[model samples]
Target: MSYCEDTIKKMLPKAYVRKHVAHEIYVAATHFKNLVPMMDKYVYNDGTTKDLMSLTGTIPVLFNDKTYNIPICLWIEESYPQTAPICYIRPTREMMIVRGKFISSNGEVEMPYLEEWKNGECDLVTLLQVMAVMFGDFPPVCIQPHSEPEQASCWLQFQRQAEVLSKTDGSFYVSLLREDDQPFQQDNETSC
Candidate 1:
């Protein structure tokens, strides 16, 4: 049996056979298909290994009434169905967070849901929900346009990080994954 066929059997409904892919790696090339006609522009480029599944996408998140597309990734180990996927948000250069319990600039996540991840009982959408809550709390400290000489003492910085961590919780992450209808115009002259 070909590699593509084997991979599809193990991780189908997400991946299709593609000999033309770069390096001949078969990946689930599209976003989860409960999406719309035009698919609302999801920007995830992720795939699976023989015993692993990974997803990397810049998902749009709304916090404080503002939207930010954050780069996120998750790796589901071969031990899934009983374990959670290791997940994290790729930090942009303009952002930093020194005070997150389950978050870091290096994409290390210690979220509770992930610890409680269950195979056949959990999935990407559930993972997205956890991320939303994490983003809302720490929310990626923005880079300043100008440099300031204002120096913060260690105590002050530590205190700030602590404050941010205190409010962090594993809630409000999955609210963003919605299957809304996308506006599409059908060409009346063409048919599939």
Candidate 2:
């Protein structure tokens, strides 16, 4: 089978396991293709692998010393070609924590600091560009009252360490990976 077919076939079972997983993989692959080349060079977090794509309106924001990639999962009807994907990122032990948002794909409820993504017009390239512009180095910093005060603090530390790390460490390092997962693959000729 052709590479695309093979990749799709390999992904089919996992996709079946969870539609979101498949979608995440697809989005990651797409984002990887569009993102990596643009980077002058940088290392990904150890063991970090791109999972399925979930629509997140959360633009990357810096508060304390850490970077938080936020996404909101909202209830979206099944209307292919018209309906955009509803995906979100929830509060995790190691990442940013937000209030009233559990990371799941069911509901139309509004979220805090949501930035309503224009899914119909968005693509992997545009998405990555958006990420780079929003969350890229030298983002404007701000403090919010109440709720995620710790998150705000984390960003401060993250940036300080990141500066030192960037200067002292190698910019290019292969990320650790599980045997079951393959690195993202890109087709130069393909368009999303």
Candidate 2 residues 1-192, lDDT tens each?
112323543544342333433344355445443211110111223854433323333344332333334332222222311444333333323343222222222222332223444545543334444443433333222122234464355444333323322324544211222233543222221100
What is residue 50's positional error in candidate 2, in angstroms? 22
RMSD of each: 13.1, 15.6
> Candidate 1, residues 35-134: lDDT per residue as tens digits?
1111122223463324344555555555545556666556554444456656665555543433356665455777777777665666656566667656
TM-score: model 2 vs. ground truth: 0.30
Candidate 1 regions exceeding 4 Å error are: 1-52, 144-192
Worst 10 residues of 1 by lDDT: 183-192
In lDDT terms, which candidate is top?
A: 1
Best by TM-score: 1
TM-score list, all predictions: 0.49, 0.30
lDDT of all predictions: 0.44, 0.32
